[model samples]
Target: MSTFDEKLKLFAVDLYKINAIKFGEYKTKVGLITPVYCDLRVIVSYPQLLNTLAELIIEYIKKMQTFDIVCGVPYTALPIATVVSVKNSIPMVMRRKEAKDYGTKKLIEGQFKEGDNCLIVEDVVTSGSSILETVKDLKNSGIKCSDAIVLLNREQGGEKLLSENGIKMHALLSLTQLMQFLKEANCVNESVVEKVKIYLQNTQVDPNVLIKNNRLKLSFLERLNFAKNPVTRRLLQVMCDKKTTLCVAADVTSTTDLLNLAEQTGPHICLFKTHIDIVEDFHPNFLKHLKEIAERHNFIIFEDRKFADIGNTVQLQYSKSMYQISSWANLVTAHSVMGKGILEGIQQSEGLKDRGVFLLAEASCAGSLTDQSYVDATLKLAKQYPDLITGIVCQNPLLLEEPGVIQLTPGVHLESVGDRLAQQYNSPETVVLEKGADVAVVGRAITKSADPAAEAVKYKEVLWAAYEKRIASQ
Candidate 1:
């Protein structure tokens, strides 16, 4: 074997010896239980292992065409970069998780001029957020960074996400490789290897197909690979995993009725949407119980706030208001009438990455002023920020087939055509099958039924059947 190859084998063994890769039931940051947890943070304690890892990274870096300096992600990657810099005589810079308040108060603590090409070194890559964050900081300081090197890649969506941002990811080792070494060494059983393989496949988001002209052609399982927003991704995963696309709009006026409806219909629905401001008995405990039910039922909570104010006002209304919707709601509704600033404001709130907004492009209510132009503008805005806007709430399919922006059709009813208030209703076929919408939001049809749970089951069956038919026909 080559020298680099020999070092790589030794590095893998060292990783196992140091217990950097542990075999057990561990809950990931997003609450998914995994059979193994690869924590590279422990590698810093072993100088020899750390040096070998840095050497492996340096060997890979030498193959690169060119780079000016090297930078490491905060905390875990700091020492790795330090070793690589010292051993290879490469200049190094540091990125701070939080900017120092005193001294120079620099976010990036290094002496580097602008326009220098910096290669980012990270200990582990998951969603590629850390490398992207460091890239953003470097860009703001006029430093150029187009490549990143990680000790190990979890093989989730990190590489794809980084490529989407014009950054290339180079990993010294992948999770699959580590698993192979463990399996060969008898460090983990076959079942653990299979479990990790399944986990990797579940989180892998491939970009082979474009959604431009293929929106109607892709199934939920296929579309999950393209969704950028975490909430959107989780929703698609839930729908595919649960085999339902029914969203129950709990429009009841009391928290008691809301919780009752949620518990009854949670099994058959992917989203439990609410207008929390209308709840007569709202309390902190209400939010707690609702979230607990959602967790147990494997559905997301959507608060239909319909926010349409200025940026500053909407920011406070989303997170700092009496309701604090951002604290619990995984999905929210917002009107793009006030411009993209409304999106910016919402994104600035806490836990923005975990939450998503649905733009109201068309309403099921009659005489709604959302015309074609307004819908077009709303879709245009949503396309600009795929990470923030999950989809558009509309009565009809959009003319533009934008990727990753799902369609949520509301006012769905099985029998009713229209109410006295001019609220138009469509069947599950019209929404999911005919109009190419992803979700059907049914309110009074199920909520006001004699047995909400049974009624929800009916909607769920029809909705999932329609979705299956749509994708099969494609």
Candidate 2:
């Protein structure tokens, strides 16, 4: 029910309490005397705690989609995987270290197909040798293992070893997170916390090198350099949360009218999209005033010029033109048809440092080439100049389902044949619910209404209702 960060905070606090009561100097199965230990086995005894944790895991997996088949690695992970599978309505699998002579003489005991993308779940990984062996067995059994989810990572070579074997380690809690949790809960002394921090720091590993050595599959960010930017990531998040974002595509006919519409709808929206060439009297003063209003009301001014010119020409239009896009707009929409060189020019401009360049993908308007040649071009540009791009402008807001691209859908309305006007576009509610539209851009519905503020409120309420419904369903 809570946000990811909130759930993690609560888990840290609870885990700290459990650890304090159970941990002390003890001989581990690995034959090492440890001052602190975690027996998440205790969580099984506390049904409420176990349920909460299962719910959290389900929520996280649903959001991340990091795994295809959820397979627990041996004993401790089996219970956690079972609970999570029941909560999320997904099937579970278990991996055994060695084949049992009595039962089926099988090491992997579950329904799984060859090359199924499987995620191994574990309670904790210390040396990681056991999990590596488990991974080897799974791979030998024709299951593709690329990811591992664990309760805690001790910040040791375990993560590196797993990664070296082509597996990513996703942990709900790390040693650092646990140490901080213990300190906040007053379950451990400052000296013990310091020792843990020092131990983790000294044993830190580089994930990039490990990933390379294993010839593992690259993550979304690694595949597309554009996704590494923080601005791009934030824009993607805005697009994903169907409630707070409204993707608008208005013809820039009059600055005053556009500004008025933005003010009326801005409070409930995240992006106010525009086509700068359509504006009648575009000037620096008008641009400055519009930017001011956009900031005041908590929305981004997205210039939808769709510039498809040479590098020099695009740079001039962005900085020296009457609109002065670099000065006013938080994000500028551009056509990647001009090649990566033009995108490089846009990025080289100092004034456009914080500005995001949303690439034109599947255009909202009909008779556009986005479906055929444009889509391929956009994908290539997205890979080539990912650092300069922010998001993608498309009618299929569902494309925003990707981790890095913000899906901006225009032509949204509460009621109008406007849906007929753009035969394929979705209504505001439909866009939010079914299409996963981050921002619903409405034009005539709000700006042309008798009472713009009231109309905007109606749209906002509808968006919120859709958001609540989706969250409830989840």
| Candidate 1 lDDT by residue in tens digits, 406-449 | 78989788874787888877678767754567889999888889
Best by TM-score: 1
The list of candidate 1 runs beyond 4 A from truth reads 1-213, 351-353
Residue 134, candidate 2: Cα error in Å is 30
For model 2, the superposed segments whose C-alpha errors exceed 4 Å read 1-227, 230-243, 248-252, 397-401, 419-424, 471-474
Candidate 1 accuracy as lDDT: 0.82
Top candidate when judged by lDDT against the true structure: 1
lDDT of 2 by residue, 47-88 (tens): 777788787777666656555578877777788888887877
